[model samples]
Target: MSALTGAAAVAGCGGDDAGGTSSNSPGATSGGAERDCSLKHPVCTAVTSDCVAVHDNQGATTLGLRMAQLTITKPDVLASGYVAGLVTQGLTMNLPQCNLNGTGTFSWLLEFDTTTGKLRTGGAMPTVDPREGYCFANMTAGEFEIAPTEIDAPLTDGAWSGEAETLNVPIFLETSPEPIILPLHQVRLTDAKVSADNNCIGRYNVEGLEWDNACLPGQDGDPPAFINGGKLAAFITLEEVDRVIVDAVKQSLCVVLSGDIVKYGTGADTNTCKRDENDQIVLKGDWCSATNSPATDDCADAYALGGEYAASAVKINGLCPQ
Candidate 1:
């Protein structure tokens, strides 16, 4: 087993891998660079292989959320019109409509209900590997040790809802280095659906993103299936969110709709900030760092975060490494 590790910051994700599959094929995808280091996904197919193995009959099937599709619903809050103006509108009103996907390699683990059951999901990150932390090819099931995340929502035939008090994710915003510990005080995974065969869990779709062709080399012509789709939400601290937006906290806005909040009380809460024409308490300075932790400890609180994901399952089996 390895020590607990976390991936920091999310940028252009990866390159060097253990299996050596994700890099360049040297055929044609490498159009510009000598080896195109783009995120190439594995070919999608309903693998009937039973990967749901409990560590010594421990009553849990471990899984790694190899690919994660994250979303930030409203990035255009600054340009929103009568979308229930955040300034003068009521307290609880629809902010706006826009979806911005969060990029980065997502390394997550889970203990499913049954190897092939439906909607059985609950787990955490690998005890050690943090995406860029291990070569995907060199990973083993043993390496996918469980972390200290707890969620108790069972499989249901109704609306999706599950809760985790505090979930810390190690995101490899950048692959070469370590991971960033993105803290979620209150976390929720909604509308989560598990496939019939359980080997796969998604039907994730994002137009030009992880679509049909993105599922990689097909398996006996299984006619691209987009099954990875779900909503995962949490209240993220500004420090964690800053890592994704590259520390753009000062320019960040938490529209309260009705001028209720005297101060942001969130974001980069600093004394140096002041108000402009609008009563928005404007702050300054980079409150976060991809390579470092938050500037202030008090900033570890949270802001409502909405994330939509289409994740696929990968076994925890550790294999070859370079």
Candidate 2:
């Protein structure tokens, strides 16, 4: 947290022309309402979520984000069959749990908060129904949990950054016997900003999303105390990939099509498939062997994951059933 001075109010939040304190200053609250994140989210019990509390004197704004997509670009985690492709698609699927369609209540939320002095972010569950609108599930958190539960970063000039060792990413795959948990490591989030436009954009990391200056929200160039868009980079070692996912990958990759882990040839030969003496198209290390996969393009050890994501804004209309 650096010193804030000289018209340092966030973009959307109004600041005093005098550069002191105003009704719209960063220290201002929502109409002097109690700053209790628990009030916004009733479903997020202490046992599951990290509740956020608004101090009596602090000014803060909270944004409830639903996971729009988590697309994995690196490693080419494609499948050998249609079933496998469907499984891989789950990582980027637009599930209806967001309550925007038929109204199946679900929750996978993150709280992006810009307080008077710090930038805080945390995740919690929200049981929202389409009829009920946004649940704003209790986003209260104490001391931003480590090991990747919740994190706090320095908001420098409206840009903040932080790193975590690993995080448990719960991704529901359609072709799995059970839910799939993606354990990510060496996680790094960079280029976080909240302005009319900046080099960084979007709330997620993945491929195929095109967000630029023209696509950003806001008008004035002034940045806020909290950041919005940035790049999320992480790594997943071969060992880190779950056996079930490996099995899923095996179903779609040629390397394991024959029920054996057939790696590519020695040397710089990184081919997706090669014909053997019998002319059978055999799968090699080409699946996760992308240049950015891991081990510096040597896919024998890991896979590189990258992406850009977009988030839908929702107003906290009501609380969820306790």
Per-residue lDDT of model 1, residues 203-249, tens digit only: 42223232223322122112211323577665544433333321212
TM-score of 2: 0.43
Please report the TM-score between candidate 1 and the true structure. 0.43
- Tell me the deviation in Å of residue 51 in model 1: 16
All candidates' lDDT scores? 0.34, 0.33
| lDDT of each residue in 82-170, candidate 2, tens digit only | 32233223322122211011112223334455553232332223322322334433322222121224566545565666676666554
List where candidate 2 sits over 4 angstroms from the true fold.
1-60, 78-108, 116-148, 173-177, 195-229, 246-300, 314-322
lDDT score for candidate 1 against the true structure: 0.34
RMSD, every candidate, angstroms: 14.7, 16.4
State the weakest 10-residue window (summed lDDT) of model 1.
91-100
Q: Candidate 2 overall Cα lDDT vs. reference? A: 0.33
Q: Candidate 2: RMSD over Cα atoms?
A: 16.4
- The deviation in Å at residue 298 for candidate 1 is 17
Stretches off by above 4 angstroms in model 1 are 1-64, 74-104, 115-147, 157-160, 204-228, 239-301, 317-322
